[model samples]
Target: MKIKLALIVILFGLLTTQAQDKITVAVGTNSTFIETYNKNSWSGNFTLNKAYRLGPTSLKTLKDGVKTSLKWIELNNSYYKTFQKEVCRFKTMEKESFKFHGYVDEFAEEMTMIFYGESDGSFKIEIKPYNSYSIFITFTNLDMLRGFKDLLDGKSANNEIDDIFKK
Candidate 1:
């Protein structure tokens, strides 16, 4: 009986660690990266230094607009499409004032760990190919994105993963 109990305990421990190792990216998970810019037809040439951080989240409206796309560019990696599952997370950071900051998401797509701290209403993300043109993703929830960038820039660890569906 003693040997059986010990074996069971060991097996359970191993399973727990294995499950943790297979974590999928989602919101509240932080990330960051750096890319250089080259002039494009969409915007004029200019130098802009900015900081990405996750701060307070607030409400905003989504404006209606249409963009003319002259071309479609394919993402470099398909792994993100295969492994990354995007989902919504509801939370109100204890550190932030009791405002319902809303949902966040963390996922790996196109070789980048994306952390959109909070989605106020709407935003956009454009990932440049390994050796391609530079760009930016504009959004209402700037802090959450900033925090994610911090994670990418080594400002935070990417281990803040929690499995809500998996037991």
Candidate 2:
């Protein structure tokens, strides 16, 4: 009986391990930050931009309407260059601080990107506006998106690097 119990325990552990999908990488600012993600959740440390940055451990490809897609958030140089012009709504440029009031559907040509809050229980998102050349954001797989909204509004982060020198 004891042997059977042990075998069952081992099998359960293996199953649980297999059920999780995870990825971790040290990306931007010379790899000073460690980013990680799994299945429906992600987290990372933020440092000012320098030579390079870190990438997420694992993530799904988040695509815009045009299918311009990106997976992990790192000090990815690709974002620095303006993506070639594609079919879209309008040219949006505004000097606004960190204030995420809604979801992605509310955006127009003025804001360039509109956001709206999801009434149904779904996921959460947090964004870090680094600057013109760099931006950082994270979403949650947890049940609610309330607690972390402040993070998107520039409340607190695990690691906030002083990138005054980057400018």
Candidate 3:
């Protein structure tokens, strides 16, 4: 009986560890972000843009590893699609003077990226979901920034690929 109990405990521990496993990717483009989630069964909000604003009562705190109801308004979109809400697991990461907040969806299928710097820098990005783990992508290069811009603009990847092949 003790041996059986030990086996069950071991199995439960493995499952718990797996549930908390995180996948981090340094995103360069919307396609990369999309592809990452698609291949991993994660969820994201591709329609998110700069015009969207977080609701006043949404995400009221900045504590790490906390779960909260995320609410925001997509200003550029219509009313039906404007106000968005989701249950998310909040996580934080600090690099240099910047702090990034990741809101992973309830089921851990997607992550919404929000960042603010100590010295007047802030931005947000939405990527599809993943499990109860944090997904943070830090932009450390120009290419990543450019790619992200293209993503926000809804640019076609075909043109980018053609340009690359032409070169």
Candidate 4:
């Protein structure tokens, strides 16, 4: 009985750790963007998450102005850090044009994103594909960017329960 109980506890701990390893971050409240060609837009929260599955991470958004969501542009983990660095560099005006190009095999599409500093000091991400419509995403809150970086770094925002239990 003692050995069984110990094994169960160990298994539970491992499962909890695995569950907490996945990170999800919301961009902001009701933040949405329009596709340039179709002029279709949705009013919903934008989110990014790195799941416990194989392959790359993706940015999620609402689909067709509804509650249903869809993921866009699956990118490899290696590009995330470079993207964060480029955003910082672009903010300082060190680089005139910030761009990232990657091919996502899941969609069989080539994705190109361009970052530009807005006049208000915020930044916009423009997704211009060679064969598809363009997408423009404006970041109004800097905290969302920080949260995204933290998510890519394997940090969880849902630590309040742990903090409460620790205290």
- Angstrom error of the Cα, residue 45, model 1: value is 43
Candidate 4 deviant stretches above 4 angstroms:
1-107, 126-131, 134-138, 161-167
**145, model 1: CA deviation in Å?**
1.4
lDDT of 1 by residue, 2-82 (tens): 111100000001122111111111122221112222233366543322212222221000000101100000121211222
Root-mean-square deviation of every model:
19.6, 20.8, 19.2, 18.1
lDDT of each: 0.22, 0.22, 0.26, 0.25
Which runs of model 1 end up more than 4 angstroms from their true locations?
1-122, 130-140, 157-167
Query: If scored against the real structure, what TM-score would every candidate get?
Result: 0.17, 0.19, 0.25, 0.32
What is the descending TM-score order?
4, 3, 2, 1
How good is model 3 by TM-score?
0.25
- Number of residue pairs clashing in candidate 2, backbone atoms closer than 3 angstroms, sequence gap of 3 or more or interchain: 17
Please provide, for model 2 over 4-64, each residue's C-alpha lDDT reduced to its tens digit, 9 standing for 90 to 100: 1100000001112322232222222211121222333344433222211211211111113
For 47-79, candidate 4 gives per-residue lDDT tens digits of 321111111222231111011100111131222
Instruction: In candidate 4, list every pair of residues with a backbone clash.
Output: none
Best by lDDT: 3
Better of 3 and 4 by lDDT: 3
lDDT of 4: 0.25
